[model samples]
Target: MSTRREARVTAARAIRSHAEDVVRAALVALPPRERTRRGLAFHAYQRQVRTIMRADPVAFEVVETRMLAEGHRTSVIEVTLRGEVGVDAGDMLHVLWRNDLDRIAAADAVTAARFWTTPIPHRPSRWARVGASGLLESVVDLSASTDSDPARAERITPRFFTVAGVEASDVRLQVTHTAGMPPRAASFLARVRPGDVVEARVLPHPHRVAHDGPGLAVVTGSGAAGVFAALRAGASGIRLVWGLGDKQLAPWVQEELREHLRAGRLSSLRLALRPERVTDLLVDEPIEQMAWIYVSGHESMGAAVDAALRARLGESVLREMSDGLRCIVST
Candidate 1:
């Protein structure tokens, strides 16, 4: 058989095996009275299993498998499948199990004949409202008040903004990270347009900031992490502004900068030790011209940038700041 066909067959088998294991364990866990002839639990589980077995086998692929933390002998498998088949299978498995629980907890005997299933609740799609007025206005807070950890903050944001038929080229993003905070909401960087801007200061660890297209990037820090992040993001034009104190770049960073400078991708390099200086540089351009602005890191620096932008653009600009390290986003 062909490799693709073999993979599909294997995936089908894995899904079937997983489904059977879960059903069998759940059935076994029920008390003797719950499994008696008059009970609907056994029949419901059997029907669900049969439905799973009759599903289009080639349509499903098991992507991840993990044991339940509840210490149940059964395992949960995350499946990637086409169309409504996956949804139907999930409803059967999850709702059938829940129905059995409801039957057990009820004062009156609840049978399968009376079991009512509810559709799974889905998150509302609000992507249409994004950039509706030819600009993007949103605040991604990674401070203690919202989500303290940048990694956790990334998880809360949608991985793709295409749900409402928005294309990558339709939006531009300007992101700035400061005060040693890990880059938050960097996933959106993957969709940033050519003219988008990215700026960072003191990235302690390597983070994926790579852009899908060439854009402008600015890095201000003594460490090389910020510069490396900008380079990885495929920035066609890069400007490095040195941070506070007399700091020297690592030998490798210096070498990389020189190479990019020779190639014309690294456009300008300078020094801006004070936060006020950085703020001045950030607001050098007209705020009304940009589509979106995301500022994060030190509260003082964020406030400074916010004040500068508001001062320049006045009420025409929309700005929001969160607690902890003030993060400002303007449109």
Candidate 2:
């Protein structure tokens, strides 16, 4: 191995050792009940680190530590890896710290804490419906408002994750928001390595329209991932409509959409600033001839779209519905 490769391997070993120590110390300080609850997750994280170290050989170093509200501190870690490893550092960090941040802080005698990793590219996986069986890569929080109820907002704000180990020609990312891309969405996009070819469309709220054909897909709400799945399955055209309710349109939103239009990925895009019903944004298009129709965002929207499609197409359309997004494809 070259000198740099040797250094990375050595650093990776050191990180593994330190992580083991930290986890051990944290476990010892926890009460038995808490320990039992956290031990499994902690060990699973450790194993993930070990897996990366053994196969990919990456080095991890803390770049910055920031103090947050309520005495919490977040540490930003930069990951360095050579070649393809099929590991998403950001998603790994999410699995490591999202739910366990508070527990880690309590055991370590620090404040509530979080962890984040800078963007790094690995490999792509098989594209399927958002909730379909695949290696879950990242869960992007798409909530637009602070007052939005988590339970209710989760239905509309889609979680975007990628499967691993598939050779794909391209990766398409669709982001819908009232103003511009959310911070979380930007972060998720940032993680795409500089070398990856990603076609990203940032659009305003969509008002539904009629479908074209098997080569076409219409996505309402936040089901961009459904379009991605369609693209992977060789769908040639995509229509994205954002349902922003009564939110005010920011000038930046249109500028960004114009930029995407210049770059060209969406077959058509629309923005609806004010709509009579938010659920109507789900599937306003006539779906008799559509090859794939995806409605994601709200449960009520999913039901309405499903009912409408069923009423029109009867049982001929194969349907897959999840809590967050719904997929309807012709057999």
Candidate 3:
């Protein structure tokens, strides 16, 4: 049996090597006569796919693959991509497959679906002005006020969380450059000089800390800013599972978090490097023993945490707070 990495390489190579045929096959609507008439058209389309692949480099790790339906010659393959990228399997294939409705449908699109090729790591993202917070994390201001700035042209503003009366200035973000982050987004952030504008946005985090609650926050991954605010707003007993993948961002978000920890604002802080699971860090802890918990992180991690918490504390002690689970596809 091929490993996940091997399967990904195989998929990517197969797609790239036979791109022309795949595109042709994808154009299910094309009549047999049109294939003869469109000899040059396929070549042109092939060139476009080659160009996009060269820039993006299609690669993916297969989380799981199964046969959904079988045709005698070709089985209906279902795959889920590993890691995080904004682009889903369908969208990625769509770009290469062009506008073949039947082809797209057959692919069984998913944001993080498995792939046959080396999954392209780059995902598309919009530009936004960089706001300096003089801290470890960079801020991508997406408020209406910042969106209209000349620096931000034709960029999509991300939906962010806020209380009904809260203004833009009151919103603070801690943008972490995860492995799944787009190259453009990372480059703009990396080379950004003080006061320089860059392309970015705050991902939509629907969960907010409840107005009145006795629960403590269990924040992992990129949901730091919101939890920090909740702590400042007098939400007590924070358990921060800081998952720092690769290099640390400036002004050092940990410094502020550490300060809070020292001040007793945080109940605990566990740091995990890349390839380390946040769930592992939390597993042995007496979290279930705690009566109330408010959790936040990327969806996958959040779900794991929720399950852990539920098993430990049981349903009775668990009070509902804000759902800080991130919706976008990312690492």
Tell me the alpha-carbon RMSD of every candidate.
23.7, 17.5, 21.1
Question: Which segments of model 1 are wrong by more than 4 Å?
Answer: 1-227, 240-242, 274-276, 280-296, 314-331
lDDT, candidates in the order shown: 0.30, 0.32, 0.37
- In model 1, what are the clashing residue pairs, if there are any? 210-233
- Which candidate leads the pack in lDDT? 3
Worst 10 residues of 1 by lDDT: 1-10
Assess the local accuracy of residue 130 in candidate 1 as a C-alpha lDDT between 0 and 100.
Answer: 21
User: Please, what are the lDDT tens digits per residue for candidate 1 over residues 71-124?
Assistant: 122111111112222121002111110011121232232122211111111211
Greater TM-score among 1 and 3 belongs to 3
- Global CA lDDT of candidate 1, please? 0.30
| Residue 221 lDDT in candidate 1 | 31
TM-scores for every predicted model: 0.29, 0.36, 0.39
Q: Who is ahead in TM-score, 1 or 2?
A: 2
lDDT tens digits, residue span 1-331, model 3: 0011111133344455456445544553353333332343444444444444345323333333333222222222223333233321102122111111222233322232222222321222222223222100212112112222223212221222221111222222233333333322212222223332222212222234432333345544344445555655555566656554433433344466667678666778776655787667877665544434555556777777767766765555443311122111112
Tens digit of lDDT per residue, candidate 2, span 176-293? 3332333343233334344432222111111121133332333333343344333334334455554444443345445644554454445566644344443354355545555455
Error of 1 at 258 (Å): 2.7
